[model samples]
Target chain A: MTEKDFELAGIRTVEEQPLRAKRKWYKEYPVVSMLFLGIMIVECFFCEQIMTVNPTYMDLEHCNVAPGRKFLFGTDTLGRDIFSMIWYGGRVSLLIGFVATAISTAIGVLFGAVSGVASPRADAFLMRAVEIVLSIPNLLMIVLLQAVLGGAGVIGISIVIGITGWMSIAKVVRTEVRQIRNSEYVIASKCMGGSFWHILWRHFLPNFWPSIMFMVVMNVRTAIVAESTLSFMGIGLPLEIVSWGSMLALSQQALMTGSWWMILIPGCFLIVTLMCVTDIGNSLRRDSNQRQSNL
Target chain B: MSEILIDVQNVTHHFKLNRKTAICAVDQVSFQIKKGEILGLVGESGAGKSTLARCIMNLYQPTAGRILYKGIDTCDRRQFKEHKKMLQTKRQLIFQDSTSSINQRMKAVDIIAEPLRINHVHTPRGSARAEAEFQLHYVGMDAGCLDKYPPELSGGERQRIAIARALSMEPELLVADEPIASLDVSIQAQIINLFKHLQKEHGFTFLFISHDLAMVEYLCDRVGVMYQGRLVELAPTRDLFSNPQHPYTRTLLSAIPLPDPKRERNRRKGVYDAQKS
Candidate 1:
């Protein structure tokens, strides 16, 4: 125990080596998805400059033209450039996805937070209502609501999808909020006399935000899919207003004439965008699960 | 005699599992804490020590009886509302686990300043941050930990931050529910000493709940022993150690292991018989 015994033992201090923080490059950041999504957004943003011809300008002479250097992605049945149409319609598709997701996430977060903080009886009633809404198929509800709303424009379809899509996110958020509401920090904040809004903003949001994020991104994909499905059924936005959905809707005539590019190009774009979105959402869910397990 | 700061009269709490079943956690427990004294509550796990503490902190409304803080009935909603600010600012709680007690996303300084911000207590120490820094130093922590989050700190450091946060409000009564239970032995002693020193200097009432009998003996002005949701013995620290009244108290006292090997070899562990008692 003494210094003399230590000297006899020949104990020496080694300089401690600092560990470099392990940067989880793959799991922490979905680089490939982000890059793809970014490129898509940029391409849509510069649609006007990138298009070689007007997206909606119909030329009778070039009807049913096959894909060639003169007409990239070929001309559709009405002779509009499919390449230009994809970019132009992409803007509307992404816009619908984002706006619809925003609306649904907002409604869902608000509903879930209220349910989580409500009394047991009120919470039960609210959750039962959500369950009832969830019992119906999402696509059926969206389609029914879209039909009722008359599918007037992009905004109308977005609203219809948003209203129908919020049930799932609300359920997810309510579970997260219920779990977080019991956490000691939230209780401590309450004991300190923090108001409901104060606790929600300062404590609850930070604790439950990661869990809600995955559902939000997934909602975006769901919204886009809903728009496409409605349009494919010939009940979505009018054909005059160009969107990926409306483009696909117009492909019915192209299908009869054997113009394959009309159906193939738009479907690929939609599927790729959806896959990237799903990948990002999966990564976020993984990140949140890891965080919860660590805790 | 010192004036009583907290008065619990026949307080009882029950957790209802279903329509036909309920678990009585605290059964008609009554106790009084005087001003500026450290009262220790000790019992085995599941003995309703935490339930009693929560009831006292107004975190749970007892199924029966009531608690009075400075002659104000805290259970009454109207009375609590009337004195909400004073009740909130004048009392604070330190939970057993600092990891969950403190917000992980917040900085140490912000955690310490939160109560002040919430209660709108004008910081006579200039700013809330300055007051927080003063409290940190008072709890024997350096200003270097000001910006660090709870996850970045060690166990002892996190507990210290939790202590600093509770002390920042300068509450008249601080209820620490097994504050040292999750800490290492060495850190436990350090925190115990810190509590002792702080009590002597600040002259604030404390309700310290712990299962460590030796610690209760060393640091408390008085000790209350609990068993099976009931108070078995309550007495001065010296009297309780010198002469325990209840059979359960004797059993608890006898369970403290001695440091001397020869004497420890001859030590007999006492067992309690519920039927006989």
Candidate 2:
């Protein structure tokens, strides 16, 4: 505002001014990342409609075909349509990513909130438990758990990843809750007879949502990588399930036959999805920080 | 001779720094605030004025002694739990810094109605928002600012909102801890006048803590002078200002600057050595 504008207007008039110029949603958010994620979701949701050939249909005649007009992403050693596999596999990947992240984030938030509000001794015990869980290598635990359960499916692997992934998120939430618990506004709420749930809903959730979102996005990337790692080792979802990880499981044969498309195409899809999620998470964190600083 | 609304008895609060040492923020201070009376507490910075106010508000559990409000010992956990609703509703606190006191993300109306909504207090005006609007106008604030956040408003306006929130509960006892310290000099006078009007019109009891001696002298009925966490003198505002007893109180009185240039030039500053005392 200029000095002349201030001279003409009163303090109330100045305060009434809009904080910033309004922008369209596209302008406000990361457009490219949002578009990519939206497309991925829509494409994966209609995989059956979009695929011309079954993902598991093996043609013995055309084996190890390179990128050609007949096959969008070429053919694997099994002669399966790589394009169909990518779409079909995408559904499982996205579902597992989202479901696992949701489970882990929920568990983490619960633990963190409880630990934050718990008494000193209880808090200490909870934090120690989290630390112990975090100290163990998650992959080994998942493998052991998968064996104990006899076999693994989409839900099974998601649950395994979720249970093991919550420790770091719990630690982050604990730190955030502890910091916010002592803020004057929170104390004011408490003094006004606001209950714990009320405070958590009104104050805790809104304040720490951005950080948790970032963690959730990062965890999705971890989950996808973990699934791929397990599949490559021949321990993940059975051969019947055509996930991107399962598609990549034939990498050894593809490498020996010099059919690079088998490994490269699926790897590109995974990387692109991970990058899109990371970009979206970064934008969210930035937006929240800017809002706080503006205040 | 009036009924004592708040009786603070031998209250002492200390913060443990470590296993070996502790800092006594509030010494064995005792005082009684009568119904419909304004008790102003004045002291230098770090004199435990704010700490004492927090103790009275039940924000801090005093290490020793007790505080009684309406014949119920607030210090006792069971008694506090038994009278939780009444205690929470009837006693409201206004913090020193309005910036930190009100949630920055919440609108003015929400901040004001929070106490009412939390306690589920039915207002004559039908809704909590209506009561909040009434309280805002009661504190001399315009209703136009009701939807604005704390950051959008100026310091004085934020403080007004804080005061409005406190008054929304129709609190019998209002504790203001340096409420005007962060405001401009002009706004400070306006807030002080608003406080005076509220006390007179509502007959509300006040425990006003401030570093502004001139304001306390103008606003309070009884004034208590605290020196290093100990209230050295408790007397009527006029008596304490004119015929001060404690050396620290005299020194504190002399520290107030005069408006007249000649008088200010001739003023003799009083000094008291803490070591010798």
Candidate 3:
């Protein structure tokens, strides 16, 4: 018989109308999309303020200016606008955090899924390697790597964080892959003479989506915090780049002189941004849990 | 003399526990199912009936012996791949727990249409949804079920949907592995009767594996008794029940509590054994 004539006699099909209804919630939430849109808009409009500020423009004339029409949210000892510094500083921090998290999560999911689904012998070997990497304190490993790399720019620090951050996500994804590989539908696909690659892409990946999503959101927050810590320690992006971490670092000397704007503005921005991300991540996690429980 | 649809010869399957020892799940079991015949494989939980079914479906490979489908040897790996689509189209399995067997994430129509899509059966002419609905109606379900997931349906309804999925492929043979064993006892008869009605209308062979001999006796044309990886007896259903050759078969028959208290009391007294002799 022609390929078209071979009916896989027992597989069921869904009617179009109901499938749309079943998938309605994914479209309705749009939380991730909204966050992404908000980030893009802020980045495009507010990134110019950091470059415009003359860090050495010691405006002794307007130093320590309180919240006023001329200088909104007051001026630092160096006479930079607190509001302007926050908007610009936020751009680099968010960029590094998201990029690092994306890189780490992608590496983790791919490696974990492959190792988990590979032959048992291969899986054992890969898992041992993962365990070794995980045994090292993550922060120490990133610090050591940054020291060795030396040029510790934004890209360099991001690479260091990305490499260290993937270990935990790999472990989670490996566990998920092991569980999904044994599902009946996967076995059924193998029985139907599907290729290994086909099964991996079609069955394994789709089933791994929920876990991958959870890992991605969790890792983004981790990356943001890790970037801040590194920057505070003088190992993150170039000293010239006005990131949240660099802002915090610059504010330290001024703190003794009690120019609170140096520390308070960047600190508050970091807290608010982290809170927003955490809220969205927690909501996604809750939704995933609810969907699983309902199933 | 019906045409032979499936011929399983000396199929001995073993699962390796280690280098030295193996679990003999199905040991040299042989049977032939004829077109339109319902061959009941009655056994206890560990009797290897399901393993034999899996081997026939190519889900599990037999360590030795061959399964011949319509005179073609199916045990050859190359031949199996070459004829994979044909095998799937010609043979299907209905698992015991309808809810677990059907994908919970999939809607009823997509579950039914999966086999058709996989085998590329719905060429240019028929829509998967239309074919799914037709098969659902064939198993006494309606269009409403198409929109629902497996979790949303009652046990009987889910089983019906499973049956519809199996029937959609238009297979010549179906391996129904304890299809109704998970349903409510009240719904068991309805599902059993539905299988019977479908067999009558579709004229497909069935290898019905179950521990319930009474249901098997009512539904099967021939019956095979399996005990601890061995087929102890194989005969026409009437002959097997009325004149059971295997001790296990006799035990199964005697254990069926008669509906009448008087008859049941007499059966307890070994009166049925005497009558059988």
lDDT of each candidate versus the true structure: 0.89, 0.89, 0.80
Q: Which number leads on DockQ?
A: 1
List the DockQ of the predictions in order.
Answer: 0.50, 0.49, 0.16
Per-candidate total of colliding backbone pairs: 0, 0, 18
Report the CA-based lDDT of candidate 2 relative to the real structure: 0.89
Give the better candidate number (1 or 3) by lDDT.
1
Q: Can you write out model 1's per-residue Cα lDDT over B193-253, one digit (the tens) per residue?
A: 9999898888889999999998998999999998888888899999999999899999998
lDDT of 1 by residue, A1-295 (tens): 7766656456677789999889887657889989999999999999999999999899889988999998989988888888999999999899899999999988888898899889899999999999999999988887778777774688988888888888877787788788888888888888888888888778877777888899899989988888888888878877877888888987889889998999999999999999999999999899889888997
Task: Name the docking class for model 2.
Answer: medium
CA lDDT, candidate 2, residue B195 = 96
Error of 2 at A59 (Å): 8.3
- For residues A181-277, write the lDDT of model 3, one tens digit per residue: 8766666555544566666666666667776676787777788788888888887776577678887887677778787777787787787677667
Tens-digit lDDT track for model 3 on B1-277?
A: 3788889899999999999999999999988888889999998898899999999998888999999999878899888778877887788888888766766667888778777766778634289999998888888888988999788989999888878877888888999989989988889999899989989988889999999978998999999999778788999999998998866677778888889988888884222232344
Summed over model 2, clashes come to 0
Rank by DockQ, highest first: 1, 2, 3
Interface RMSD of each: 0.9, 1.0, 2.5
TM (chain A), candidate 3 = 0.78
Q: After superposition, how far is residue A207 of candidate 2 from its true place, in Å?
A: 3.3
